[model samples]
Target: MWSANAIKSRREALSLTLTDLAQRLDVTKSYLSYIESGKRAPTPEQAVLLGK
Candidate 1:
């Protein structure tokens, strides 16, 4: 299972703002927030994109 904490940590390590990562993921900031908060999971395609 994916860890929301890990994703947030990596994004911070990369110095990416929520808006920045949201743009890269082509998702809304709220949606990304939900992902990072463990309230929601990315779709399979989104997961692939995130993996890149």
Candidate 2:
């Protein structure tokens, strides 16, 4: 499962907001929010995309 808390913690640790992260990853803030909320799962490819 995608750990919502872990994602939230990491984002906070990096001092990044959802929009900031999404902008860096070239994705929508709503999509990142969905991932953070456990409402969606990123595919391995998407994970790699986000990891960049």
Candidate 3:
């Protein structure tokens, strides 16, 4: 489960801005923001990709 906090902190720890992470995931920055804010969720495949 990708909790919003975990997603946010991990990105910060990696020094990655939302736009950078979103591009890596092939999603829009707005969509990534939605995920980080708990307004949306990533699919299982996306979850797996997050590990890479």
Clashes within 3 Å, all models in order: 0, 0, 0
**Shift of residue 17 alpha carbon in model 1, Å:** 0.4
**TM-scores for all candidates?**
0.90, 0.74, 0.93
Model 1 CA lDDT for position 42: 84
With a 3 Å backbone cut-off (N, CA, C), the pairs that clash in candidate 3 are none
Better of 1 and 2 by TM-score: 1
**Window of ten residues with lowest summed lDDT in model 1:** 1-10
lDDT of each: 0.89, 0.77, 0.92
* Model 1: residues with Cα > 4 Å off, grouped in runs: none
Residue 39 alpha-carbon offset, candidate 3, angstroms? 0.5
Which residue pairs clash within candidate 1? none
Q: In candidate 2, what are the lDDT values of residues 1-52, reduced to their tens digit?
A: 3476777777889899999988876779999898889888776766775555
For candidate 1, lDDT tens digit of each residue in 13-47? 99999999999999999999999999999888888
* Reference-based lDDT, residue 48, model 1: 83
Q: Give me the candidate number with maximum TM-score.
A: 3
The numbered model that scores best in lDDT is 3
Task: Residues 10-46, candidate 3: write the lDDT tens digits.
Answer: 9999999999999988999999999999999988888
Q: How well does candidate 3 match the true structure in TM-score terms?
A: 0.93
